[model samples]
Target: MNNTTQNKPINGNSLIEIGYPENEILGIALKINKKRTGFTKAEMLDKYAQVMSSPQDFTEDKIFKSLAEAFINGIHLPKIDEEIIPLNENPKEFKIYGIEKIEDGALNQMKIAMQLPVTVAGALMPDAHQGYGLPIGGVLATKNAIIPYGVGVDIGCRMALSIYDLPASHYFEHHDILKETLMKNTKFGAGHGFHGKYKAEHHVLDDSKFETNSFINNLKDKAWSQLGSSGGGNHFVEFGLIDFKEDDKKLNIKKGSYLALLTHSGSRGFGATIAGHYTKIAKDICKLPYNAKNLAYLDLDSEAGQEYWLAMNLAGEYASACHEIIHQKITKELGAEVLAKIENHHNFAWKEIYNNEEVIVHRKGATPASKDVMGIIPGSMTAPGFLVRGNGEENSINSASHGAGRQMSRTQAIKSLSQNKINDYLNDFGITLIGSGKDEAPMAYKDIHEVMNAQQDLVDVVATFTPKMVRMADDGSKED
Candidate 1:
């Protein structure tokens, strides 16, 4: 399988985390043909079931745990080094600048990264948290090839910003009725979408892409249905107040401040499933047993790769549609008009010229802070977020932080903060509060100020926003 793929399947610099031994796992897994592989899917399933039936899987878990430590960079392993979170994740050779936590899973990912290499330079932004393979707040740059998993299953998953003319106080005046209307018009959590709500027009085919397949055909339905829905986990939409009135004394626009609505989500499960399917194809084609499973990628020039690129872009469009649907819902309930909306996807790949090389730039939790790039910089529910533009700082590859980095994990947030505290914070803003489980409370993330300060070399802030009523998945619903 690897023979048919590009010759350059390995990346030395990116292989650091999966260095030495972890590639063996991929080698072994690939050697066993899916049909003849000793650990067939059936056998693997049986093993998983037995392990679940008792605790045998714990042994594999422990083995994987140890192997993960060896492979993943910025990961914490039991028998590994002391409690030191580096100011820069890859201090040597790589330019990653921050490492807030290095847990076991992250280590495992490093071990897995040995074979699949990334060209996109990374900074491991302060909000770094574990996701499929790439860390939630992690950043990466790649050349020639684009890793599907790096952008994640939720291709084009990102944050959105909508500015408003009304002040935060205006929401308070319409409180109860607005909340009722929002709930009725908008739906949150999994499987939340409006079936057949949009009109899908076929785009003229790009040069390398092929005719639409059944899978692609189904996507049309998915998009229409998933419109206006907010997927579970950390995905959310909030009404916030910008506190930037001349030296922080203003609540009005004279302070260059504005009331904003902020939200975080992705292309929903439709994108996730497509990403998963192709990621597997990339892995199988690579056949070399990469150190990081999620680092699977496709060359931009190949037929399959072109198909993925087209699909990925389409998914981004769908994600934007989802947000637009939400904005409409909010407008209907609040009876307000939107001043402007600035939306960008931090996940997904871009075609750009880096170092005079025409390359595909895959930004995984990082926004392109190119000289003209305009994007949002969101904070926690109670902190300040911003809308910034890139000054074309090459050191950070013209990229900036995604949001206020996370200081604590979801479990930690739930343990440390109380419901009353959450309630108090929301009340102080006098904004409508809605769905958000304890996992995504404001305390779960890091301070936005420090994160921005550390990244001053990357981008310039155009505006800052403070939270009014931040809504996320509620305590009673599914949390990711």
Candidate 2:
């Protein structure tokens, strides 16, 4: 029998007949030991034979209930020398795409996350790589719970693309102006914030959610200060050419090529603080099994859970606002009007219904792909990114990989990859770099084409983007 399967309540009395709100100890014990919380009367009697025969309480009901609570909470169960059994139940096996390409470390992390009692279902994308709790391309659904580490450190990290009315050739003709716009409008790298003339303003700063929770309120000043800046690591902003050999409603563009700007970033320091604060809270309260410690969860009905939901959504808005500011400022400066845009977040959670049951779906480094929903999956700076629409496959948790998920860690790239080789590779791909580090070299990632191919059923490529000019963090700096 699947341990995660919902059990029927005893005569509609949840924790009541066995001592509900009146019995605080029993409630805590039930919460700590999830398996034996609502056992049927017959099963209860059979499982606690010693407790049922105890004479101290005289009544079977009183004696068995007390012993059950004590047994679950690791306290003395009267004079019974009984050993509590562990919940050795397996969660639903995760459906993985491109399993052969995924690393063993990432697969191990996925197994641990699946062991979490809250996990309802899980999926691993082709771009899977080891991350905090869930792998970078892992998707997880939990029952009335949310995992902070599963959402990862960079909350609301996303990709946005704005297509322009100008032809692809226009970028080269006005290269200097486009370059100047990027330089003057956006700041990149770690701790890069709006200063002097580059400071940006957005309506997200006025959101009430910021003050709804102390965590968001405390991050307001910092969030406002860095409104338009892009965080470091693989985060970037670039000019590229989007190709569509056939007309599509998703893009609403003719069968031709056009100039586009793509930006990848998150909620900056604001997100990091919220993640750090709530992750600690989750870890402190939920004492999960050893392998599942990083996968600690908070019940949706809890105060912290509600607060985190608000904070996470607010961070998404902040991230979108940052993208808007970057695109608006750069486009306006370049005198280029927006034709159309595509945007989607990869690092976030949503209240989704899967298997006809409501669950909190967390996509760490994955994109939500609800049937026909549009999203962006980027590759390395030099490789191609895809404009896709979700196929809404249930097994995949309606998601796709966020990018050409890292094939190598930052430390590995920095050590083995030389600047000259990176430059040569970029030049070979006709990618012009404005600012970047060797750590983000194209070699550091898996082939974008292969990743897209692996998840073909999850998403359909509507268009492809080839980077012409890219900007990212410079060498020898801390990652975001």
In terms of lDDT, which candidate is strongest? Answer: 2
Candidate 1: where is the Cα deviation over 4 Å?
Answer: 1-92, 99-120, 195-211, 243-257, 288-290, 332-335, 412-432, 475-480
lDDT of each: 0.58, 0.75
lDDT of 1 at 336: 69
lDDT by residue (tens digit), candidate 1, 398-474 = 77777775566554666678989887876775545577767677777777777787777777776777766656655
TM-score of the candidate numbered 2? Answer: 0.81
Per-model TM against the reference: 0.72, 0.81
- State, as a TM-score between 0 and 1, how close model 1 is to the true structure: 0.72
Judged by lDDT against the true structure, how good is candidate 2?
A: 0.75
Measure candidate 2: CA RMSD: 16.3
